[model samples]
Target: MAAAMESGELSEVCYPQDNTSCRAPKQPPGQAMVIYFLLSSISLITTALNLFVIFTISYFRQLHTPTNLLLLSLSVSDLLVGVFLMPVEIIYIEVCWLLGDVACTLYYVADYIITSASVANMVLISVDRYMAICKPLSYLYYITNKTVHVVVSLSWLCSMAYRLLLLHDHLRKPGRSNSCIGECVVVISKMAGIVDLVFTFVLPILVILVLYVNVFVAAMTQVRRMHSHVDAIQSLRMVKKRELKAARTLGIVVAVFLICFCPYYSPTVAGKETLVDAATAAFEIWLTHFNSCLNPIIYALFYPWFRKCIKLIVTLQIFKPGSRDAKII
Candidate 1:
């Protein structure tokens, strides 16, 4: 029995020499290999897709509208998720936290900041669509490029500050929640969890829902007006149609964001303290990151300009002179 116990300890421990080391979860070799392959593929694809989005919007002068600027900010955050967070998470699934507690804390800090910024960008997109649809006459004046730049900057700054405060305990004492070496975990108290839920998830989602409801109603009204007034000016009808289409596309993005994020925060809603670890929270973490990959695909499906940009990018035609001025829309 003693020999068997020794064998088990040797096999299960993250470090056999360190008796206090964390136990590693057991999995078949084949299964572990397959899981690693699938996760690596997702990380690579996410990085590549967001890169395409970032470049597409930035390179094309015609695509420099306020709405695309918001998308650009979102893609940047998603790109960070793909480049940094996903890879770290993939490693965390099967390996010990070798980079030490400081790195672990910093990794999560970056994760939260990027995630908060992404949510903020989504809210801004909803606002932009709301103005364009519900108050079209003043949209051009209110949602200009300069205004968008200022708002995007403020969102990022606020996200960073907010996350720093929320995770201050972890920052002050790295690895405070770890029970053993080789483990990285964070424990959020009930109070902090509730605050995070209310500020990050509940309020943003409520705002998005309310604005979209109004936007939808106003869009339907405009559609009815266009149909009823057959003598409406052709240009005016076309503009309204374009605005309605943009709202529909952006609404899909917001809906997907909600679906991906809801399960992650459901624990707080259920009156549980938020405990984050690689093993238990893996599904929620990956689901949130997966949204980054889906956004570019969504754009490719709904925006002809995105498909055209992809073609030009693949064919190397973007390098040609005056490609920026090409009629993509």
Candidate 2:
């Protein structure tokens, strides 16, 4: 028995009758159950939290603003990650790709589109906060709800187009990258990987960092100026404080996103082609998806409005008439 195991004779094939099928990894039954429970828990929590965020912003009229609109777009993308991407990944953790090659290709296409949309939404949020902080005078003029709506629509459209183009090869020839019958893999060439890294990760992160730095400086300057104006209008002071606090909260969201995604792109950063195979890239893939779970948690911790919204949601208060007009912020 020991010799058979060592000689690969005891290895499990994804398809017992198919000689060319991929070998399934050996996982203890007890360990598999534990992993399934943990991953399923993450998926449930992520879906529930992002749903709250979506409902809070969408249902409350008072929460409808350019910034909240950007957040709403973000929540939608994160919700998709929780609902769709994470569950698929959990399946990949312990199973062969039995869904066929075309399905595998389509799955990755959706994954890329959702991820790109999430990053685009983060960029939009940073731009919104920067305008509110550094360009306050013209913020309302430039960052209206209509404008945000258009921008968010364009972001999603662009994400779809970009991902489709990026994965055109895979779309053209499903299973081209897979080495075995039951394997689902996408091998990105070095050049394509570099381009993806630059647009999706490097450029967006740099823009976010630069915008937040300017926002931080401007916020500090405004705080000092308001303090020196001992007779500043009370309402004006309150508005400034609110904007500053928002910037800080969104900064945390961006920071957490960066932390979660950096490791996933580390191979690309090191000049390697990005090979995305569920069997081999489980840790990095799950880490990035975990960001979806963290975003709503950050909001719940930092935003009082979110906590209030949660209370209303849990107690079924949102179904009440006039709840839409309730003060959320």
Candidate 3:
């Protein structure tokens, strides 16, 4: 065993002098290569996909509706997750964190803020769809661009505040809970885990589900009354069609969000303390981040506008003059 350890083939310690220091996991040659490749590929794909969303919505003048603005906010968060968080996470797999405890705490801070904001954006989208479908007449007056901007700003601000409070102790005393040197870890109490699960997961999901059900009912009713008005029938029908389509598309988005987020928060929901560690963090974090990549795909599947935008973007037609003025809707 001593000979094998001396050979440097089994485990590698960060500090040779301190036998109690954390040892980096020994990854088999092939497994390490494959894992690294997969992680790098995911990071690239997530960045590209969310970037496409951000550019498409930001560039197109016609796409500057209240709904797309909320999507723009979401895409921004997803893009940051891919660009900043995923690369660090990939490096964290086999390597010990060289960054000090303060950096580690800040890293998790960024993660929580981004993740919470993404969830809040989903809630906003669901509410938007609900208002459009269920209260069509008042939708324009209530869900204006100004209001949407305010909501998005508040969502981000609240997420940051909530995360700061949740991680207050960790921020105050970095690495106070570490078991060994060179290991990055944060421990949230079971009570805090429960609170996070409720506020971040349960309440938001409830709101989304309830609002979506009402939206569905209203959409079906609108479909039935399509021929009721004779004077403004065509205009009303056109608006209703748009709203219904948006509801369906965003319903898919909500479904995807729930599927991705549930597994990540499962451990917390199980009445256990949430341990942010290398062992089980990757599966949950990557699974959640993968939803960012999937969102654009969901849009492509359901929104014709997204498909058109992709065509223009990929063909470099977006750079041509008057591309922004192109009719997308």
Candidate 4:
């Protein structure tokens, strides 16, 4: 990986180069192109659905809250990645990169900035949920809407700052339209990977783990106090159920990110720091696209109000203005 990187093969660890605009190997013909088109269609449809849901939720004044607002931001970022970026990437992978260097620089910065922001938003949301579930009394003090705004704004700013290191060269400028460049290298610099691991992955997971642990402890304490009057087993069961619900949702989100992203970081996981081939790059692109699609299902099932909206859209005739059954909570 290092040698290929030294040869100016792949871009840096942040992968600042636009894959769609880079000169990748000619894709083998047949089943590959067919699969790529299908995947592209699925990505586009999912992005559209996410945009629709996000806009609908935002349009309703009453549904606005910190948690949902964070989700709105994530959906917007993911949708942009899916709608504007991934289609070109899918085509590039199935054929050849046709977009020029200048276009690539624009797309690269735009894509990673948004991707980085999505990670930041998730970390903030996890921290918010942790406070809400565990430190109920302190939650309001720690997690006001103003706090959310500050954290989210800072997250984007921080991500953009990380991205700026890549833009300090000819790689980021609007150059001659058709300048044929060599293959972009794999962005290595274990240092950047480590920082990403800690801030984007480790800290948020720790917050989630600690928050859930505290909630369970608090619930058990309450259950013990009620044991003489009520069935202790029943109280324990109820507490356990809610704990599992929150844990599963947050765990799934974190786990998906780790699985999709971790292998690219080190030897212990995948035995290399670079993508194996064009196939791996294609897979990585689609896996990231799939990640964006998952939040809708997560939101609809995990949040009561979002579930209400989905139920309204599915069960009742939503087109009818007088259908009270379609009302959202």
Best by TM-score: 1
- Give per-residue CA lDDT, model 1, range 1-329, as digits (tens): 99999898787878889978998866589998998999999999989999999999999999999999999999999999999999998888988888889998998899999999999999999999999989887997788999999999999999999999999999999999889988988888889999999999999999999999999899888878788777756678888788778888988998999899998898898899887878889999899999998988899899888999999989999889999988887
Point out the worst 10-residue segment of candidate 4 by lDDT: 268-277
Candidates' TM-scores? Answer: 0.96, 0.95, 0.94, 0.72
Candidate 1 displacement at residue 259 in angstroms: 0.9
Return the clash pairs for model 1, or none. Answer: none
lDDT of 3 by residue, 1-329 (tens): 88976858334876656766788856898999999999899899989989989889999999999999999999999899899988988888889878978998899889999999999999999999988888766987888999999999999999999999999999999986678877888888888889899999999999999999999898888777876765668888888888888888888988988999888778787877778866557787788888888888888888999999999888999889999999999
| Model 2 lDDT per residue over 1-329, tens place | 88878556635778767778988865799998999899999999999999989988999999999999999999999999999999988888788889999999999999999999999999999999999989988997888999999999999999999999999999999999998988889988888888899999999999999999999999888878878885856677799889989999999999999999998898888899788987778888898999999999999999999899889888998789998998888
The superposed Cα distance between candidate 4 and the true structure at residue 191, in angstroms, equals 3.9
Write out the backbone clash pairs for model 3.
none
Candidate that beats the other on TM-score, 2 or 4, i.e. the better one: 2
RMSD of each: 1.7, 2.2, 1.9, 8.2
The global C-alpha lDDT for each of the candidates, from Candidate 1 onward, is: 0.91, 0.90, 0.88, 0.61
Candidate 2 residue-wise lDDT at 12: 76
Error of 3 at 186 (Å): 1.7
Candidate 2 backbone collisions, by pair: none
lDDT of 4 by residue, 55-173 (tens): 65666556565666777777887788778767766665544433545665666567667767877776766666666555656876777667777777888888888766644443544
